[model samples]
Target: MLVNPHICPAETTVILHICPVEMLVNPPTALAEMSVSPLICPVKTSVSRLIALAEMSVTRHIWPVETLATRWSTVTPVQQRRSSTLAPVQQRRRSTLAPVQQRRRSTLAPVQQRHRSTFSPVQQRRRSALAPVHQRPCSTLAPVQQRC
Candidate 1:
């Protein structure tokens, strides 16, 4: 447990029995208060010393935030390089696809118009076939089941 001497000077010597993992996961809200004051960790009271003690408590647990920050820093350059390499390829694909998409749209327009004109009769026929089944009395099922 990280105890800021400035915040709780009397209990500064008192060691907290909380697990570092628990502390990290649900960090004491007081840490935010301690962090608010930049001058809280002056030469007389060392924040590094408190942090070192906290680090010792959680020696087994990896400091995820720090680790991830470092990892992100390393990864950012690679990501930037990859994105830079991909930009031209993406632009080229977009350029090539634009004409193809326009051509497809033009072809599909007449087909869609033809389909709309021809589809009504087929749709009506289907609806008419289903209409009789839907309109049939439920009592007819018994006779059909008996025959089956």
Candidate 2:
């Protein structure tokens, strides 16, 4: 089975089939119902605090320090207006293609390469009018720019 590089694939597939033991226990309320370990309580609490600190540190590194929310302020109206304008342009570009069109465009070149010899199948397909060479996806354009 193929695994996604960005996530822990083992944890993901296990989640699909069964609830994890930790999830079966409701952490906050269930502590009242069961006899808890004294040593474990401090360890668990510190682990959670460490996780939160680590997450915050990563975010601080990734975004500007001055941008972190302070108690006094809300987002400025000018920033909101600028973001709203850009969002629609991005969404329109994303939403224009139906899944079939998206899939056809994604898979076309890979299919061409698997079928033929050293002669470029893309040029051949263009000549045959199977796909307008002009309609080639943006990924194809990336390599030409990279080479230059």
TM-score of each: 0.30, 0.24
Evaluate model 1: give its lDDT: 0.71
- lDDT per residue for candidate 2 within 50-148, as digits (tens), equals 999999999888676335432224657765666678778888877875676878988997878776655777777667795565677676777876477
Candidate 2 lDDT: 0.68
Maximum-TM-score candidate: 1
Could you tell me the lDDT of residue 10 within candidate 1? 47
Score candidate 2 by TM-score against the native. 0.24
**Cα-based lDDT for every prediction:** 0.71, 0.68
